[model samples]
Target: MPTKPSVLFVCVHNAGRSQMAAAFLAHLAGDRVEVRSAGSAPADQVNPAVVEAMGEAGIDLAHARPKVLTTDAVHASDVVVTMGCGDACPVFPGKRYLDWSLADPAGQDVRGVRPIRDEIERHVRDLLTELGVETEGVETGGVETETEPRA
Candidate 1:
């Protein structure tokens, strides 16, 4: 890893799972890790239910927008995490790649998106552990546990 490891989160829409994962990683890792998120087919806006779910965790995604996946992004990242983007994501050798089998949160309500948000949190926590980044005041399996929020 570089002095600061960079991670890219990719999904099909970049509107839900990838957005949530990026937000969680950014919140937990702070500036210790560089976080980026993109979609295979970018959407116009973030999924509203995902935004609400993240807000429930005390993190905001209200202004988050979808980003396009690019080979340059994959090349720049030390770790590339794919959430159901499959072939849409570019593969480059020598980069750590992880594919998270997460449910799409596009059309779900806050009730349905909560679990997915929690699952992404868990995975992001695990990834932080693997990257040797320590988070403060974040509790696993609890939606309300938090510290300061970040964008």
Candidate 2:
């Protein structure tokens, strides 16, 4: 049997974007992928608005806490995704690195967080595809469609 690919999501706080990305990857990829998340400077807890937004997507992050980034984490992961963490993450030779430019959801309300959550989901789905993981049985919890403004 082939070993599962591991992915690490990193950000400055790990309270919002990284948490959401990790949850989406775990939920979507099931056991096919190993998901981890951390921050350069750890926060006390996951962002509440991020949790609520994820709840709307049917992923519970209520118990998730911010974790400090470590070199071991980067070494263990096949892919390392950074969300505005800048130079905080340690680079490894064999790891694939991706930087996602996303809005911080720290003080954002649920409404503000929803879009960021959805965007993370999209990126996670794309990553799954790249990793040769199928998302067929996963429930996406429905991303809201934007209506075009009539001129």
Computed on alpha carbons, the lDDT of every model, listed in order, comes to 0.88, 0.89
Local error of candidate 2 at 32, Å? 0.6
Give the per-residue lDDT digits (tens) of candidate 2, residues 116-151.
Answer: 888888899999999999889788666563222111
- Over 55-145, each residue of candidate 1 has an lDDT whose tens digit, in order, gives 8787889999999999999999999999998788888889999999988988888877887888899899989999889897764336532
Cα deviation of 96, candidate 2, in Å: 0.3
- Angstrom error of the Cα, residue 116, model 1: value is 0.3
Clashing pairs in 1: none
lDDT of 2: 0.89
What TM-score would candidate 2 get against the native? Answer: 0.94
Number of the predicted model whose lDDT against the real structure is largest:
2
TM-score for all models, in order of appearance: 0.90, 0.94
